[model samples]
Target: MNKPCFLLLCLVANGLFPVYAITPGQTEKENPMTINMSINQQTYEISLSDTAAAKAFVEQLPLTLNMEELNGNEKFADLAHSLPTRQSRPGALHAGDLMLYGHQTLVLFYETFQTSYSYTPIGKVIAPEGLKKAVGDKNIAVHFYRD
Candidate 1:
């Protein structure tokens, strides 16, 4: 086997690597890393990305943050600790994108817009129609937890 493939096999065999399956009509609840994000009294399901940063973020779950509003588009808070990052510019951001900036800042976008700044993927909120109203135009306390 090629060296890279052999290493991957070894990692899998040692239970040091994870494998995911994509099935037809699979729901977010079926995803092992899915989490609930609560703003005010409304809850949104977040489908976490398959990345090291997402895994690290999940490890610190059941957290509450007083996220500060920024630029009339997003809310952000500094994590108590840092996570691993694989940053990239996602040119167009949707309303429910949850991303990590640098190694410590956790950002939640509530608007659709283009950007040149790079961020690490954390997750995306499902059905975020009421999100903006829940957050309002001020800093809000948000909670994240696993069901």
Candidate 2:
């Protein structure tokens, strides 16, 4: 092939050609948000985006997670249990409220058995909609409790 034709073919093969590409129904996964939940006085840190982190944190706790219907409108009471002594206040240490840190944004949500709290972090591709749905908004006030 001629030098010009060869160059053109190379450009096309290399995807250097300006082609209008439209990605539909493609939503980027939101950045990982750190949520600190205190159950029985032990602070359990987790990232909703990281399944491994969530699993590891849950495994270390004596509390069994009822993630069966994890979504909005779920209640913490429905999933609460008497954690084993190894995971309780004297055993594992837990924080007071659920602290979420994401993209320079820190959100604290109180746990409740009703409603949902909505959150939108700046520059975050994914919103904590699932969490809001699971935790509910009833105990979502920005108030901190000392145990």
Candidate 3:
């Protein structure tokens, strides 16, 4: 590869320059964002959805809290402030689906399950298969930050 081309590729690979990253069904206008989640002293990268709610969540970055175990399938923590919500019903919960319950609680789904709740979708996890094991059936301190 040429010198300039190699440098450009390096930037994109490091997430500093996203030239044409259209995330699956997302439009070309949707820019990708990343978040970091820490549990058991380990940090995992999470890919966030491009939305107003997700943007708000990002603005509240570097938040730390103890997420409580829920229903054997998810972990949740209450946010100090309310996040703007886009009311929508979830058909099924999937691993790594970050969400907001009501306006104050943040939920991270780790197992698939049917649900009858409407939540503000925030983001999703995109790598490393050990997330489910990290968030087991116990309360854990989660450190969230924009990555």
Candidate 4:
């Protein structure tokens, strides 16, 4: 079996899937963890991934970070602390990706492109359109919160 299938089997074998029931006509799953980012005075809701890095990041939420531009495609900032990470490069990247690079740097991609760099995927912007425009090259304060 493929890795994803095997992982799912492991989760089911260990009863790791959430016990919450999915009612009829309800397509959206409950997300107890969420992150809010205010960039360029606009708020964006982000759904966090189930990863150690993501959890560590949420613990220090409500932060105002001065995001620096990188390669004209993404903005990044160093975190106050490092998080657990597995180095695996993604085939492609899209706008609105919140990622942890080398366990220390927090990267937010506002442009879609490919990369060979390995990063821990944390979450994504709920609404991705206009994200690039909102996060221009200029350094801007990105406030993060649990709200």
Instruction: Point to the candidate with the largest TM-score.
Output: 1
Prediction 2 TM-score vs. true? 0.26
Clashes of each: 0, 17, 0, 0
- Model 4 lDDT tens row, 13-130: 7786566767742443454367899987899999887778888888888888999988989999998888899667997888999999997999999988999889998899989888
User: Tens digit of lDDT per residue, candidate 3, span 1-147?
Assistant: 999999989888879755675566475246477889888988888877767888888888899988999888888999988888896888898888889999889998888788889998888888747888988789989999975
Computed on alpha carbons, the lDDT of every model, listed in order, comes to: 0.92, 0.33, 0.85, 0.86
- The residue ranges of model 3 lying beyond 4 angstroms of the native Cα positions read 1-31
lDDT by residue for model 1 (20-115), tens: 777643753465468999998899999899879998999998899999999999999999999999999999999999999999999999999999
Model 1 residue 12 lDDT? 84
Root mean square deviation (Cα) for candidate 3: 10.7
Q: Evaluated with lDDT, which candidate comes out highest?
A: 1
Lowest lDDT sum, 10 consecutive residues, model 4, at 24-33
Clashes of 1: 0
Per-residue lDDT for 85 in model 1?
Answer: 98
In model 2, the number of clashes is 17
Worst 10 residues of 2 by lDDT: 84-93
Ranking the candidates on lDDT from highest down gives: 1, 4, 3, 2
Question: lDDT tens digits, residues 1-147, model 2?
Answer: 899999989898879656665543232234344444443343444444333323333443443332221233222222222211111122211222321222112333322343233322111112333444434444432211212
- The predictions' CA RMSDs to the true structure, in order, are 9.5, 14.9, 10.7, 11.1
Task: Indicate whether candidate 1 or candidate 2 has the larger TM-score.
Answer: 1
